[model samples]
Target: MKKTIGRKEKPYMLPYFQMEEDSFVITTWHDGQGFNLYTSNERYKTLERLISRLPKGTIIEND
Candidate 1:
């Protein structure tokens, strides 16, 4: 008989964000997940800058 090992899946987190500009939006997900969604802007320079400054293990609080 052979034994098999199972892999665990990552948990999903809720997303939250604030509109910073007409072309870009900043969003943070649960469990310290963060990313930016570009509505129309393709440059994405500002979004990249902001995400880089975020601290590790940082989560967004919901009201």
Candidate 2:
């Protein structure tokens, strides 16, 4: 799936990730919560893999 960086409904928690082209960006949410804790290269890789496995258009209700 294409990695589009943007808000996830919250503001405090920013979910940052890179797209297939390695373009990095940070996304939070409209509610303002749930930011990404992974900063290291390894952690980001792990997150990328995990998120990639999720089904397309999977909505994360929690912020």
Candidate 3:
């Protein structure tokens, strides 16, 4: 996959992720101040480990 980011007037486009199977994918983007992660998988133990590592204020969303 690919993405467009940065200022709307001068956005930057780049290749983002790749997957061969049906498993979920994880990709990150910069939000100016820091980084943000978007995930399509919800494997419990993986999430547990991820949550354990991030700072407390990180926002997590599920579908």
TM-score list, all predictions:
0.28, 0.25, 0.31
Off by over 4 Å in 1: 1-22, 45-63
* Residues 1-63, model 1: lDDT tens digits: 333355555555664555455465545556645554645444545656544566977564423
Off by over 4 Å in 2: 1-22, 35-43, 48-63
lDDT of 2: 0.52
Better of 1 and 2 by TM-score: 1
Rank the candidate models, highest lDDT first.
3, 1, 2
Give candidates' CA RMSD values in order.
10.7, 12.7, 8.0
- Tell me the lDDT of model 2 at 55: 93
Worst 10 residues of 2 by lDDT: 34-43
Model 1: clashing residue pairs?
A: none
Q: How far is candidate 2 from the true structure (C-alpha RMSD, Å)?
A: 12.7
The sequence of per-residue lDDT tens digits that candidate 3 reaches over residues 1-63 is: 334375345545664666444344444445554334444445423667677777999886644
| Clashes per candidate, residues 3 or more apart or on different chains | 0, 15, 0
lDDT of 2 by residue, 3-46 (tens): 44773454354455554543444456467654444344443567
